[model samples]
Each structure stands twice: as structure tokens, then as C-alpha cells.
Target: MKRICILLILLFIAFNNSFGQQVLKKGFLVACGDDKLFIIDPNKSNNNHTEIIWKWVVSEAKSLPAEYIPLLKSLDECKPVMGNKKILVNSSSGATILVDIASKDVEFYAKTPMSHSVDLLPKNRIVVANSTHPKGNSIELYDLNKNEKVLFTDSLYSGHGVVWNPKDNLLYVLGYQLLKTYSLINWDTENPSLKLESSWRISDKSGHDLFRIDADNFLISTHNSVFLFNTSIKSFTDFTLLKGKKDVKSVNYYPKNNSLIYTIAEESWWTENIYMVNPNKTIKLPNLKLYKVRKAI
Candidate 1:
């Protein structure tokens, strides 16, 4: 029994070491403003851990293709899209692009002025939100396989955040002060369409990101606070995560560690910050305007 236990311990240590080495190699992608994209390697510590083992810029001058110039000029949200296959990037210059992970290629691109958020779907479909400035208050579905054509559009007030929940098989869109749920009927066919399932007021001003907690509930970041939204009953329970004039940018849930990671930026875009809410911790990052946080898969 003692020898068996010793072998198991050794195996576990080997597995952990292998995983850590893999992280040190590729790290995680972080999209900072002004054409900066970094691969950060996070290391664990016994106390307050802010030490990044190693990191390098991936979206450098040479890596960006000519077509991606506009996107690099003013990148907003940079996180791995659905399935962790490509990075979904939204830009202030009105571009939505999907970058291939291995090839470093901008596989898909679209011009969506004032585009705030995006959600990837099956069959090369993407749902995007336009919040303010040029052509605001709209949610659109673009078919990438079909020359980036608009397949659907719904009028919502200052549409900002969009997410596709596989649990309820619905698309949740957040606007200035509302949450709209839609049932994607006949989505697999050529005649795909969205039916309005429900709509409700979520906040007084504007709402930001939507992080799925589970099939029954999710979390929402807004101008005032973070809110827990239940899908079962279609209700909201508030959590005071934001305060004192700080605007929330994104909230992401980490399933492996069972934690929540969120970002907040000043109204004037002076600071980009990250906080671990579950453990009540903060991760140090370079001075750059960031958008979203996603766990590296």
C-alpha cells in the first residue's frame, strides 16, 4: 500500500509539472488597446501572487496582416471566442474579426461600427452588438460564410453585450437598460430566424458583459453593480461588485478554479484593472486599456 501511494504521488507531481510547462510555453492571450496583444504566463504562489513568470507580445507589427490594421489601431475586447479556436476581437474602428490561433491569420472579418460585443455561433454565424456613436441601439447576426451579410437585426436600446447560452438554447442580449432573450428557431437551416422570447428592464443606464454561471443563472456587469440573473424564473438578484463611478467592462467565470474574474476601467480610460471576486484578490497587469478576461483552455 505504501509503494502504491508513493507511485500515485509521483504521477500527480509529474502531471502538474507538465501542465505548468505547457502554460509557460503558450501562456494566455490578452488584448490591450493600441495593437498590443500579449501571452501571459501566470504562476501560483503561497501569498499575494502577482508575478507573471513570462510573457511576450503576439500581435506585434509583423504578425498583423494589412487587413487587420484598422482592428489593431483600436482593439476593444480580445478574448478567445467560442470553442477556444479563434480570438474574437471588437474594435472601436468598427471591425469584428476572428483570428486563427495557430496560423495567426485573420480568418474572418466584418465592419461593425460602434460594435461593443460579439458571440460566435454555429454555421459561421456571429451575433454582434452596437452600443453608441455611429448607428447605435442594434443587435445583428452576420453570416461569415456568406460574404459577411446581415441575416438578422433587432432594435434594442444601446445594445452592448451578447451571449449565446447553450443551456437554455437562447441568445441573451443586453442593451442600455434592458435584457432581451430570443429563441433561435430553425437556426440550423438556411431560413434561420430569431423569435423574441422575453424582454425586461435590467438596469437604469447600460449593462456590460454576461458571464454564464450555469444553466439556471448567470452574472451581469453594469454601470451600478454586478447582478445575478436567473434563467429559470427570469429574475435578477443584485450583487454590489462595482461602485464609486467605475464602469464595468467584462466579467468571466473560471470553471476549473470555481472563481470569477472581472475587469473595470475608468470612464476616461485611464486604468484597466482585474479582480478575482470569489477569492477577493487582484492580479497585477501592465498599464493598458483592456476589455475581457478568459481562461486559457
Candidate 2:
């Protein structure tokens, strides 16, 4: 009886240790302009020095039409959704697509000009950030069940990022020198719209990225610097680590340890490496025009 009790205790400890490690492991999804999305495990090393456990090329999406392939070039945003089972990807070239991770299936897609970022909303809806272009410079909403159809539109100059805040039930958009929030109007119906709730002018022009840091805070990056925004008080403070960092394309923060993984546009609007702090490592990938990196939730 004594030996059996000791064995059970040891097994319990081992299980807990393994679970803790899994919870702390950092994995990310990378969007490459060369038309690929990669899921990387930073803790593991392969022949390329970084383990790419999963990857998706445009050609691998069998369900996508051949005519739409060109629109998906220059992949810019890749955000994991639905517990990382699906990824929402968009490109500067002009497309936003939702892909099933395991099946490599194109679930939903739409042509969004100069698409920079995308987010999934409640009630089977999604939003796209359309940057500067003729048909761009607007925040477009769509129904996931109906592909290639725009449900609603609102003008936003140089719109670059869209994030849905579940806590406040608001949609936050980042644009050129502007940050705005909208309350969903008639979201349950087919003819839904967005009613502007509030707006704030950023310290500088050309807002590039907006990502949620926590329930009450969001991380915003612009052409000049990065700021930590508090939703409760509607204030912005410089994120000291990348306080004055210019041309930051994407920034994702893990609040558990206050660690960050981000990318900066080194060659025009893309880079060949992803930067991380709080262990401080740069993972370089050759022959890829990497644009954005998001935590694989």
C-alpha cells in the first residue's frame, strides 16, 4: 500500500509538470508575402534552426478558385481563430480568406483591396481592414456563410487593423492617425450596420497594427512608435520597449511574462526575420518575405 501511494503521487506530479510546460510554450503563425502561412515552434529546432510544424501555401487550398490565386499574393495577416483550428489570412494584394488548419480547405474568402488585417466577429461575421487603394480605405464587414459578398461598409482612411473586443462587445479599428470603436447595430439580421461609438486621434499618422494585450488594454503600432492603449480610460502610453521603433508591422504580447513577438519592415514593407524579447532571440527565415506574426492561440 505504501509503494502504490508513492507511485500515484509521482504520476500526479509528472502530469502537472507536463501540463504547465505545454501551457507556457510559445508558438506563432507567420504570414509570408511569398504566399505562404507557417506555424512555427520556437522551442524546437529543426534543420532550418526553427521548426515549422505546419505550413500552408496558396496552391494547397484546393477549394480556392484559380482566378483568385493572384489576389491572395503578398500574404500579410494570419490570425488564428476558433482555438487555432482555423486561421484568418489576408493580403495586401487583395484577398481575405479563412482556412481550415487541418484540411487546408478554404472556408470563406472575399476580395478586400490592400487588405492588411482581419478579425472574426460574433454571429457568423468577419471584418476586413482595407488600406489605401481605390476601392480600399474602408472597413468592410461580411457574412461568413455567404462568400464574396459585402454586408456593410464604412470609410476609414488607410485602415490597417481590425480587432473585435468580446469583453466590451465592440469593434475597434486602427487607421491613419485614427482609432475608432463601433457598436454592432442589428447584428442579428442580414442588413446589419455599425454605429460609431467613439473615436480618438493617435499621436501620429499611419497607424499600422492593433492587437489586444489584455481584457482592458490593446497594443497599437504606428509608423513612428508603439503605444499601450487602455480601453477603460481611453488613453495611450508609449510602450517603453518599442517606444520609438519605426515601421513596426506587427506586435503580439504575452501578458503572462510580458514577452513580445513582433516584426519590422526591413525591406520596404516586409522582413526576413521575426523578433522576440524576454529571452531575446531573432529567428531568421531565408527566402521568405515575412510580414506579420501572431500568437497561435
Top model by lDDT, which number? 2
Candidate 2 lDDT, tens digit per residue, 72-125? Answer: 878999988876677899989999999877667899989999999899999879
Q: Which stretches of candidate 2 lie over 4 Å from their true place?
A: 1-26, 45-48
Root-mean-square deviation of every model: 8.0, 7.4
Best-fitting candidate, measured by TM-score?
2
Worst 10 residues of 1 by lDDT: 54-63
TM-score of 2: 0.89
Deviation in Å, model 1, residue 293 alpha carbon = 2.0
Poorest stretch of ten by lDDT in candidate 2: 17-26
Q: Give RMSD (Å) of candidate 1 vs. truth.
A: 8.0
Q: Model 1's lDDT to the true fold?
A: 0.67
Which stretches of candidate 1 lie above 4 Å from their native place? Answer: 1-31, 44-68, 240-245, 254-258, 278-281
Writing each residue's lDDT as its tens digit, candidate 1 over 52-167 gives 54332335334344665755566667666544545677776677777654445666677777777888776668888877765757887888665457788878777778888888
